[model samples]
Target: MDRTRTRTRYFTPSEVAAHNTTSDLWVSFLGKVFDLSPLVACFQGDPLLLPITECAGSDISSWFDPRTRDIRRFVDPQTNCIRYYTPRGRFIHTPPSGPRSDWDNDVGEPWWRNLQYQVGLLSEKTRWIRIVNTLTSQEQLQEVCSEETMEEILQRYLCYNSHARSYTWKFDGAILDMSATLMENGVPDDDQELDQLGLDRDTFIPAVLLHFNDDLTEG
Candidate 1:
């Protein structure tokens, strides 16, 4: 574990209480489970932020790549709706109603319309953008931590904002893995306590354990 990397800043209890982040979004667990800090900081965005440019003159199909395998969609912030495009150059204005039970689940136009209705209640400025690369197979990290390496992960402490929110935290992956093995022997995380109390002990203990383990492994 890299001590320097794990030292990334986190939100304090006061900070967390003050934040009004979206209900659907979640912070990356100290870079443990998910890392979205990178995307949040520097994703090629502004496509969704812009109010749906006059829909009449808008060529929505131009925003999508039909060759991509996954369901390519973006939120129309103006309408507060998520939009998808088809290979035939058509726009889908709705999303699937329930959880996706199958990998190949296909949503019809009716579902798309209903999705639009739901998104309309969300913030008008924030939207999810769909990235596409149809030709070569590429691994775009869906879960990001920082804009660094893919391995040797560390978790992030995210700050939430309610009015402008998306499906998840918007960040890139970092170079540290919180679960990596530590090099030190006989040192347990419980031995150390935070500078403050009242935080979740279970979560804090595991965090300490993981950090200590990484420190040992690196040494």
Candidate 2:
């Protein structure tokens, strides 16, 4: 038997979920995988690392969405300036005329520039699932089976609804662990249709439930 390990060309959402830690941080944004472990190490103890650390081991796709309301909070409408919260509890506001204002103007590119961290695409076993917010009764049908991970789904869900402050998910009455891979917990990894996951076209898996959280920072 060959002792050499084969590097995976694709990663399932569950697979990505397993690396959510400073020592093994990995996140996917815009279908690209990023191993942020090295970056995490460099930013250790830094406040700048708060956002990334909070999202380690998850899909950051929602974070890059330009339409996301979260960005509006940091922007000064009158000046079109962007306020960046620093690790030292400082605020760095960049005016529209600033060189780095391009980042605020176009959020996706900065995150896309991190492609050097690409690992692989979403695994073939991935499946899309419908997630519902138990509090507001809002629903988002997500392709969990595709390249997107649970983290990504949740992020997008939150971004779409302004009333939703925070959320936590559960499957089969048990809280869906963000750090745990769905594949390991019995989610089928195949090219099957929605029915294969025990769901109908309009009917979703009742196992997963999104619960609102008071802590808005919890991702």
Candidate 3:
């Protein structure tokens, strides 16, 4: 079953960049080539609440090495700044080990919060693309995995700004306040006001769970 040896084909540097597409693009192509990529399902929430722009201007010198694969920075036709992609996996600091008295409240952390935020903004619609490559430098993405390094990454995130040509009240506010509001109020509740807005209470809370799912469900 190790396709890497049998069916796997290798791409040279030019090939990787010449036709390399986002992850989503690979999924469609993978089924035709390997028949292994599945249709990754997710909830209909705000997919990219936090953009990778936050990671810009951070001390990612260590993560930028070729070994860890923690940090990836690039400038393409999409967002103009450096796009940092890290190998972030989900972790459960707390478990829903107890009874499901309030299953809604028991939602866990989401594995893709940081990346989702970035992808969400980049992709206009609710869906985005994901591409996988063995040649993807490990050192580039490694910065997101370490706790100490992640803290540093977040600090830089707090300073990120979207140079949107349009005006909006949301971006004008402080990042901490915006993130806090999203944490406390972004989730939809049964409350009359939130219900009218079509938001769900459990929607945003589980983003903290970090490992339950890849794509988020609608909140």
Candidate 4:
């Protein structure tokens, strides 16, 4: 008989949340979890240069992209919804001829590759969804609502509107009954999970309209 042991590679939400401190940090990106404890040590005593400490033990999936070197995505306030920016115009390309010529033309892989700090897989329940407000035409917001109520979801967006108390939520063209709890309504309670509301994981929930009541005193 042969005996061997394999390391565990999957992690639950509770397990990941437990390590959400600067000294012991873990975050998930692109479905893979990473332990950032070592990186935090490098930035110790230097809080101004880079604020990696702020992201300790937090899911930074939205903050970092592995494809491009553009750092704008990390700092943009509208990180959730997609927006197209005007191109910076074309530039002349002059080929360099030297022993290291290949390096000049090649763009390197994402920064995450250098860290090699993978820890485990992200639990499915922790996945998030991007919701858009068609009425305001504002940036989309991401929400993870496996355990939240419909009222709770509404509260999250209240800050975006001038009249927080006067707003209606719609899904698939039907107005949602805000009074009903998401769990009881059977409308996919979790943004990541599938529900009869006809929402796909990748698709955005459209037209969250806000309407203010007429001020009778003004009349």
Judged by lDDT, which candidate is best? 2
TM-score of 3: 0.17
Model 1 residue 45 CA deviation in Å: 13
Runs in model 3 lying further than 4 Å from the true structure: 1-7, 12-23, 26-45, 49-65, 72-219
Native-to-model Cα distance after best TM-score fit, residue 77 in candidate 2, in Å: 1.6
Clash pairs, candidate 4, are none
Worst 10 residues of 3 by lDDT: 120-129
lDDT at 60, model 4: 56
Q: Estimate each model's TM-score.
A: 0.15, 0.42, 0.17, 0.36
Ranking by TM-score: 2, 4, 3, 1
Clashes of each: 37, 8, 41, 0
What tens digits encode model 2's per-residue C-alpha lDDT throughout 40-75?
Answer: 675578665677778777876665444552222356
Q: Is candidate 3 or candidate 4 better by TM-score?
A: 4
Any runs in candidate 4 off by more than 4 Å, and if so which? Answer: 1-8, 48-50, 66-111, 125-219
For candidate 4, what is the TM-score? 0.36
How would the candidate models be sorted by lDDT, starting from the highest? 2, 4, 1, 3
Off by over 4 Å in 1: 1-179, 182-192, 195-219
User: For this target, which candidate reaches the highest TM-score against the unseen true structure?
Assistant: 2
RMSD (CA, angstroms), candidate 2: 17.0
